[model samples]
Target: MSQLLEPFREAYRNMELLPLLTETALKKFWVEYGTETIEELEQLVEDSPSGDSKIIFAGHRGCGKSTLLAQFGRRMADKYFVVFFSISDSIEMSDVNHINILFAIAVRLMEEAEKQKIKIKPSIKEQFYKWFAKHTRTEIEESQAGVGVGFDLFKIISGKLKADATIRDEIKQEFNRKISDLIARINEIAAVVQGASQKEILVIIDDLDKIDLGVVRQVFEENVKSLFQPNIRVIFTVPISALREVRMAGTLTTETNNQIVIMPVSKLFKQGERYINNSEPISEAIAMLTDVMYKRISRDLIEPEVVKKIIIYSGGVLRELVRITNQCCRICLRLIRRKPDDLDIKINAEVLQEAITNISIDFDTRIGNADYELLQQTYQFFTPNDPKEQRFLDLLHGLYVLEYRNAKLWYDVHPIVTEILQRKGKL
Candidate 1:
């Protein structure tokens, strides 16, 4: 019984160690994995002597955009001026109509300049920081204000800045011109920083794609593309769904799509596989996955084969793979009574089934009304026993629904969604 319970115990211990599997977790393990992409981005930064090229990286969610951006940030910190900001955190559509995203960019530039020991004008610096603090903490403040909050205060400030006659007529005049004014302000800040340090500023907007689709379009089309200056280079991540939405809306032209680069995480994994091939194709993929997974979550409780199962179940989606590994760890812990040592125990078909069952129960309980229909359709189309459903299951796995193991796929609804479906008799 002790031997039988060992794998379960170990899995449980692994889960205890990893509660949330995010890009940060992956970075802890595979520091060297994204070196090439970082180098390419660095080269892009280096080649732009004038410092004004915008780069958009679009990919599916959980495809490691944030991780790649973090890697780029680390590499460029010493070489060129770099400020990483997420627009989703700092700006909203309503906010955008008031103060453009360029304000966020300006704030990021100021912070990075301060970090690099570049001296900025004290008053200008304080004003930028204050504005940034206001914007960054907007959500919290709105919640605190409760019922009486209005856009009037924000408009008053904008009016004051615009009506200041002593502030150069051109500057004040430019300030009132909507998005263009924001760009001018960002350029002014960039110019000030550049004058002090003689370095070009690269503002990286990571995870912009993770926000609402409409907002994503508004930022890129209305603010970013329309108002950007030549001296401030903006790099941001675009979500694949946003791209599809833009295409469907007939807003994304061929030229715009060409400007946006799609970096598939699967391609990176394939490259890693080549670098670490042993004998068999399946063995090589599994081995590479184990090394990668162990690096992300450590190799204390889970075994290589179990990691392989997680990866196969993940359908090459890095986020899903980490999530499954993390979940399995939790499941094993809940089932076992004692600490287990072996991290190489097999996560057989039976264990996989059990995990999915638990996951389904958890998923159904959490999903909301708006997402119910989609979740139901996904489960009905991706059953494990049907060969005809493989493609749909693979897509679902890519989207992070099913887990891939031993080159075979396992179907499980999200715990919150699963509960809903069960109640509806759709499971």
Candidate 2:
């Protein structure tokens, strides 16, 4: 009895609530969208004259965009020396700068180079620490000889700069003063990576999309030139909300040469005047959604109809699906104790609806009727066109409004959110 419950307990204990970072998890739960997004990126890299490209990829938070980028880096590892890192992992999202981003990239590059037995010049390290210490007004602590000095130095610099706002500002000013030098050092590291791997360096900086919209504007809009100045093949994740607000001519535009690529949501619904599941082609989207749960837990442990209901509620967003499924697992455990049905340990519709009801309660806390109508129309029809409908962007970020693609793009409120609205006669 204990042995049977152990796997069930452990699976939830090790549930991947965040993006998949390891290759093993990625392989076991991977799903193909039949979307050529990665292929387009590869083609761009292959056809580039200088073997260098800078791109901005945007998607809603928790939309598996990070997972997609990570898979891309893994797939192209043979041809491109891929170094993927998350910016928010090292810096505070509320207060981020392009310089902080560049610094993180440089540190990650150095780390990757060391992994590949390539050495970064000690002079570059010394120069970086010198500038860092000068701006922060701190004395460099003495270190034991050859005691992982590079690694220790990196930790100290990143830790201090992120924590101390005064130090961060000073460093930003210093970085601005020596922006050209910083660029040179970054390019120098890029050169080594390309030379050692016999391929171009591809840096996928993930999690920038998870930052605040204001910071997104600061990094990609106001400072677009500086952010894109790094002389390397790079892809930076931007927030989906930024696309509707920022001027796109230089960075994100329809121009063939523009660097931005709006990775549309992996298509789930068929194109029509009305929304319907893409069942005619008989794709395995539903199966992929189920496989994600099975990869973590046993299939028989979960009822197929329960999983299907959760998938529909997820509105085809991968993170939303995982979240709802996680809730359902909890519901199943509670229901199992009441009934003691060891022979049929599965979630059912009643518990699934209860789980969704709990989630919907949170959705009801702050919405006004005007916002409710905006959400309703956005969910039912095409995406709302009124710039005043910025509340919809908030809904998008909050996972209440899901972005989807047919021939063009559209938005729909999360099933649970809509359920709450309809229950109130607003939809």
Point to the candidate with the largest TM-score.
2
Q: Where in model 1 is the C-alpha error above 4 Å? A: 1-27, 34-36, 48-50, 91-100, 123-177, 222-224, 245-257, 267-285, 296-300, 336-351, 360-427
TM-score of model number 2? 0.87
Q: Judged by lDDT against the true structure, how good is candidate 2?
A: 0.70
Worst 10 residues of 1 by lDDT: 142-151
How badly does each model clash, as a count of residue pairs? 28, 0
Cα RMSD (angstroms) for every candidate in the order listed: 10.6, 3.3
Candidate 1's residue-wise lDDT over 1-427, tens digit each? 4453755454444433322224554455553444555666666667765567766676656656676786677667676577776655554423332244455465556555665657666556556545543433322232322222223333333333333333323332445566565666677878888888876667887766655555665656654456345467777676655544434224444423344555554422321232244622355445555666665454545554555556655545556566566666555554553435543344455566576566556554544554455556655654434323433323343353433222443344433344446778765
Each prediction's TM-score against the native?
0.62, 0.87
lDDT of 2 by residue, 1-427 (tens): 3233555565555455788778986877676753577887777767777655677787777778887888888888888788898886667777788887887777777656655645445555555556545655656753411335655655665676567777767657878888877777788778866776677788899988888776776777777677767888888787777676636434555322566666665444554322454444224667776766667767666677777777777777777777776776676666556655464655678767777887788888867888887877776665776633468667777777767765666676777887888898876
**Model 2, position 299: C-alpha lDDT score:** 69
